[model samples]
Target: MTKAIRSPALVVRAFNVEISRIQDQTSDPQTAAFRLQFWQDILKKIFVKEQVFQNIPANPIAQELFKVSSAYSLSKRHLEKLITSRRDLLQTKLFRNLEDIEKYADDSVSSIYYLLLSVANIANVHADHAASHLGKAQGLANILRSVHVANHHKTVFLPMDILMKNKVSQEMVLRGVNTDDMKNVAFEVASRANSHLEKARNISVPKLANQIFLPAIAVDSYLKKLQKNDFNVFDKQLQQTNALLPFSLYFKRVLNKY
Candidate 1:
């Protein structure tokens, strides 16, 4: 939370949001791929030693990212992983199994943690371990929350394996079916996310990195609410924002717990 890293962290997060929204913003797969390529090319230029900032595109996010990357000696591979994962997601919208989703979470989510840790100069394995589990937890929770919207787009992000195991079909989800089978799938996915969150909390990370993991509280809160709603991913109550979340996060941050 020091002033030194505040701007860099914000820039990195802004970059993540931009990359994540590409799929939602573009209807054409080719357009999405092209946009992802633009990021990839930007990353390459950002990492180049000869002309570090000279050839950077006229994009604010790219420009700030280059500055942070140079200032903090951020990992090029970690930054590249973010774009590559999004590119892969563009190519394969549906996951085959829970493990596939976890891998996607690691690539798309954990890479952010890795970069943040680098910015904070934290090199502990324990911190990285916690970040890995936390990323999976947050990523899975995000997928659960997006079920309604993804279905509206005629796309299903629930793992195909889980859906098959629960006797739920993609069409069923796309049609916004609120059956017991769909609830079962949600329950299973939520349970997996909960397990990862528990594991993350069990680890001992550096105090400096605690703030970085505050998203855990949000993930934990959503899972609890999902359970209360009987694991219904399409619950209208789930769509409403938690007004107390800000207070909750502030309390946790004050307690030095993530």
Candidate 2:
């Protein structure tokens, strides 16, 4: 991102991170909903054109979000989707099926891309399409990556339909049981993510938007690593950071390709 958009982008991501972590930050459902509502209220204030600059929240993330929202004319719907989707997930922790997960991704992940594009002042349909697919890919990949940690908390984000189709039980996942059925579940989820990544790459986004899509490289790397391990989400190697990821991102950025 250029210096002009970098700070705003970071602010958006910061708000996302704060919202995404609300579930883990509190075990009580009401508490989580209340925290998310706090953000929703802040967003309402941020989007109010009359008092956006005058009545900024004391919270640092809200303050930055207020500035970003006002400067870029960011869509309140997109920002609200981020909060509402996470709040919905907080209430219904597990997805019913692949479609459910995709909807969640579209709301939680794709909204960030839409906001960033606004920051860059790019409004092409191709860019939005690419953002939509990449968001689903990254969102699915993130769930796969977090399976181990989520299992520790006795929480399973894997779609229940997939688990049922493979005859993998919630207890099996919670126990960290590695089995053929478990690997099959992982394979199906990873394949869906990979498919979305392919579609994202096939689309030609605006040249200026390539940097925004750099996350595609990281998503591609993770899917490849997951494949190499034979779709074993529990593989220890998957837990380690890929040392080459930074270089790969930069290389793609220089070529203006995501």
Lowest summed lDDT window (length 10), candidate 1: 46-55
What are the models' TM-scores? Answer: 0.98, 0.98
TM-score of 2: 0.98
Local accuracy of candidate 2 as per-residue lDDT tens digits, 64-121: 8887777789899998999999888877889999889999999999999999999999
State the lDDT of candidate 1 residue by residue for 28-73, as single tens digits. 9999999999898888888888665768889989999988888899
Error of 2 at 16 (Å): 0.4
Kindly report which residue pairs in candidate 1 clash with one another: none
Poorest 10 consecutive residues of model 2 by lDDT? 48-57
Which pairs clash (backbone N, Cα, C closer than 3 Å) in model 2? Answer: none
Candidate 1 displacement at residue 254 in angstroms: 0.7
Misplaced by over 4 Å in model 2 are 52-54
Model 1 ranges with Cα > 4 A deviation: none
**What's model 2's overall lDDT?**
0.90
